[model samples]
Target: MKWKANTLSLRSLLCMPLTLIMLSTSITSAVIPVKTAYGEAAVDEQQVRTARSYQATLSDWKRWAADHAYALQTIQPESWSSNGGSIGQDKFSDLDILIPLLADKRIVYLGENSHGVAEFNLVKTRLIQYMHQTLGFNIVAFESGLGDAALGQGRIKKTATPDTMRRSIFGVWWTEEAKPLFEYMKETHKSESPLRLTGFDIQVQSPLFQNANWIPSIKLKDRALQAEQEVHKWRMSKDQSGFRKAKPELIKVYEELLQAVTKNENALKMDYPDEPHIVKLMKRALEDRIRVIQEFNELCIQSNLLTEQGDYSGAQSMMEWRDRAMASNLAWLVTEVYPEENIIVWGHNGHISKAQSLISTMPKSMGELMPKELQQESYVMGLFMGEGQAAENTREPIQLNPIIPGSMEDILAAVGQPYTFMDLRYRENERGNSWMFERMIASYQVQMPMPLELRRHFDGVLLIKQAKMPTYLPDTHK
Candidate 1:
């Protein structure tokens, strides 16, 4: 997880004149004449001519590269200003140029390098609003727990104020900058034409009906409380010798709890027949929680077994399980919840990328495991910055270093723009167009030597000249 040093040396290695070096070696070795058919030493005229021709070709190529190396000017993006919050319909005219290209796409993925970039979050909010208003995109999915985000959505549906909705979101999205997005969603939701918000991640925030306030009847509330206590005991248990013996008991408790919740859902439905929306929302949220808890329980069981067997690598399966669960949940959302609706997915670049080019050894991202039909209907957009400040895991300020030479970011920075959008699908059929073939190589937590093929990995890239850390809201745990 170290940043690469001596980039100047790496650049020199990449730009080395291989043809000239090879020609020099050939010249030194060609001095000795070959024996002719008559046993007389003679210079092979054909071989000498071929070597001279190759040398001439190499010289021509060197001159061509020197002359055309700065051809990035030919691909300059249509300039647009991203100055403030005035990114409405009138200001979108310049960006309207991309509508035709994206019109057929069903799913548009917006990605960011880090979670705490103010500019990225702002731009994404603007883009989401514009897309939803203009392109009929209805569902907006986030990389958060389904139950927690759905609970937030329900609150919004009930016209919750911005501050209340802000507190409802879990994880990194709980920031001051994200408040505007929630407020916008609340203002936009209508009984006749509602704008839906959902999450497709696998991390569960809280179990359904764990609090007494959520259950209507005292009997049901007491049942939920007893189940929660038992589940907690199982989770906090440290007696390995009795772990296997407790599995059946744990399963029985889970099943009973699920049945109790299901019974409560039916009871609420009958009691609140005039107000079915709340009941439906609670039921869906409970179902999402159940799925996540079941997955987690299975993961714990497998990890414990692996630990007993002395195979610690099996612990990593938990991540694979989470990823697979996320993908499956997204697929279910698309097929069952919002069929025939175009969706916008927002997450970190690593999670939404079509391939794990950033982390070569990691499991396939959610986009990678998507069904082929869904894949064809998707367009992945990656966001990158040249230089900026970001927050480390410890919330300490860290700087984004200058672009490395011969990298995709370096070539884009040469365009000398504050912001630009490049469609990677554009391919040029010209020689010496290394920029078109060079892949995107980036590093965050670790130094990644392998580069992602721009055309194959991402449909487009949004490049910002500089970035700054987002202003986080007060920590929820605090």
Candidate 2:
């Protein structure tokens, strides 16, 4: 057959091994040097073969997916209430399919592309409910302020009203989509065995972080209180310029306060015998906050010093420090607070991946760290969208581009499902192709180097054909 000038010869294509062809297709850019009559020129052989092979493989995969993809009816009836309400047995039958996969896993991570997607948050709520009711998951964690989350957990344990629980939560979680989750948690908290809520981030300005004065005045001396107030004042200013200048001072004083608290932990517990459990929990949570703040402070210091020295890798290390702190806090929560309970973690996909992305320079994420630390069964599920609008860190709208060809997104979108789920763990065997284990391409506002291997990084994927932003809670812009 005649081939186009830009295409590869059939003989040349047939000469290459399928493994090499698959590897070339997985790359972000692949160029084959053609021996032209005059000089060498790059041809799109790799891209062509990748597209063709992927198309054929995807056609077969879809046939398989049709049988495997869980139907919406299995998850919930079409007439089911979107509002926070009790789900019936029929609705749970869909989630029951996941029970075997989750049976041995202690930590289940559900990740989203953006924080503002209403549908994603709603689905997360549903899955969380199923996991709680069916799989016996008791702890729910977020990439939020640990102090604030701990305070919210306390309120829920006390059987506080929904309004109180909402107020106790950090504003980042104050979206209309998040309302049902709070409602469900509030209702569940009144049960004989209640669920727990916690966070694992370094944000210090959350309401609970600002109001961390419950640690007895005797234990926290006047000097430490004054230092904390000073840091709080700077944080409230919201002036990045001023905060950068004062950050070093803030770190110094915060470290001093942490030291004081560490020294007086025994005395504080002894002084409050009746509320020992509460006091101990609060102490541990506060210590987590301190560790996170210390990490952030070190990041800032290292970044500045590195910038001055013209070494940028320090900035990347700063990012890694934050993730490490998150991982540490998560480990602490499982080991100290709820050793016997199964925990569900919610966060952006980046933080929950088990492998490094070709695009990111940071070290392994909390998802990677946690499983290794616990040496227990853990699973990660990443969410993707074919096309839609997403919010940036600054709350600006960004239109998502179409699915990239040869990527997992394109493969799943072609399945002709509005929503679909794929268990990546067993996809390799199902597809009978090692290519299925390769990195799955994704799109980002800032270009990424390459995609991450789907099978290695994620246990499962939840794909949405179209996505839209959720309604933000009042005065909570980001």
Candidate 3:
């Protein structure tokens, strides 16, 4: 029940002095009165200093935006100018608005709850639009693995196969930026595109609807399943005999779930402060998850060396489950696994931040993972949506005609012309649509190029706050 990490304890020790000073001098303290806010007449000086420092960072972005508003407008949607009959590249100095925040590329860290944060949603939409339109990137690999397959693929011309993904609905309310991207694809590349979506996250199977798993594989797996079925029947059946028979299977699930939850609990407690009661229930649900994994692994293990593709029945499942099993250590893997001039991953903010999630065990900052050469070779940036700007007020979203490497010229061409958006805060039926607001916020552009020390692994960070600023063109070249 006591949630604490030794590392966190160490961090507190290092920050305590500054924290104390910040607490004493914080504006909040003065405005609220020391006694009223802290129940003390005097506050620690370090607390005040720490609070002030945090306040500055929290608003640093907005401050930066306001200071460069004129420059920002200049880097609008139609800012690019063509040199007649020659290489048409936009000037970089004129369009510094698209630089990303968080220059450290090593962490490739994004921190935000996936279920919320429209800002994250906007970023994703912009990235998808950019990659597909400009770079000719035709593949979209999702963390949701197999379940993502249900979403569909983008289009590709001259071929019966489609390369686009289906219109997705989950996690949309919070990830409002995603709506525009899908809508754009639907409208533009309704028939042709090659940006196929593939999810290696989990095997696709259904229990209620009867997926291939209708028949269990191994004897143990079958027993485990039979026991489950028996329990289900007992729960629904009109006989007491079945109830007694189902108890064992239910107990088995309870046992497995408890173990898994305990393992996860011990892992989560170091940072998250939620109650322990949830751990008990989490364990019970984990049984089904464990069974799915077990079956998938078994299938993989039992297959012959030259097994047919169809033999892999339970390989695809839920996106989250598959991602958890297959996703490598991100920082290490990004740097060492894929060998490309530049690799960009589109994921929720949570996966991209240094803060904890499904990936890391420690607070691994981006600076630590970046290789020196990459810092010299690439311009790393993260694209995030601004807090209140809309995509239109920002600019028209368009795919970079050719996904050119990150350069001052490319940035210039992308910034093209200035655009305007009206404030809809007072409008009807508007406030509930966070996606719209996210698209609006995604309008403002902040580019954070990877710092010299942390730029090797990536080129730059581009964050899109408003979803619509980037033109939503379908992958028409399928």
Report RMSD (Å) for each prediction in the order shown: 11.1, 12.3, 19.9
Candidate 1: which stretches are off by over 4 Å? 1-88, 157-168, 190-192, 210-214, 217-257, 260-316, 357-359, 426-439, 444-450
Backbone clashes per model, in order? 0, 0, 111
User: What lDDT would each prediction earn against the true structure?
Assistant: 0.58, 0.62, 0.32
Candidate 2: where is the Cα deviation over 4 Å? 1-54, 74-86, 157-170, 207-277, 289-295, 304-312, 357-360, 371-376, 427-435, 444-449, 476-478
What digit string (tens of lDDT, one per residue) describes model 3 on residues 1-478? 0112321233333222211121333344343336565466754543234434533432442342232222323222222112211111232233222222211122222222222334454444544444343333333444342322322331221212222232212222212344454444433333233233333233322221112122233453445455445433432333344344545555665464355445555543322222222233223223433444344333333332223445433332222233444343222334443333133444443233321221222223332233545433322233333223233222333322222233222222233323211112122222122221221212112232211211221223343323233223243322
Ranking by TM-score: 2, 1, 3
Residue 18 lDDT in model 2? 22
TM-score of each: 0.70, 0.73, 0.34
- What's the TM for model 2? 0.73
Better of 1 and 3 by TM-score: 1
Tens-digit per-residue lDDT, 1-478, candidate 1: 0112422233334323222221223433355567778886856444344434534543443443344332221122122223322223554554553464455678899887777666677777766766665566767888876655555565564544554444345546655566667656655553233446777775544444543353566665665555545544544444544645655554554455456556676665443232224454455555554554455555655676777879765556666666677788788778877787888988877677787634555666787878889988887887777778866544567777777665556555656666666665433424333344455464422123346666666777776667777777766455
Q: Spell out the clash pairs found in candidate 2.
A: none
Q: TM-score of predicted model 1?
A: 0.70
Writing each residue's lDDT as its tens digit, candidate 2 over 87-152 gives 454556656556556766789999976775667777887888777766678788888767556566
> Residue 125 in candidate 2 has what lDDT?
79
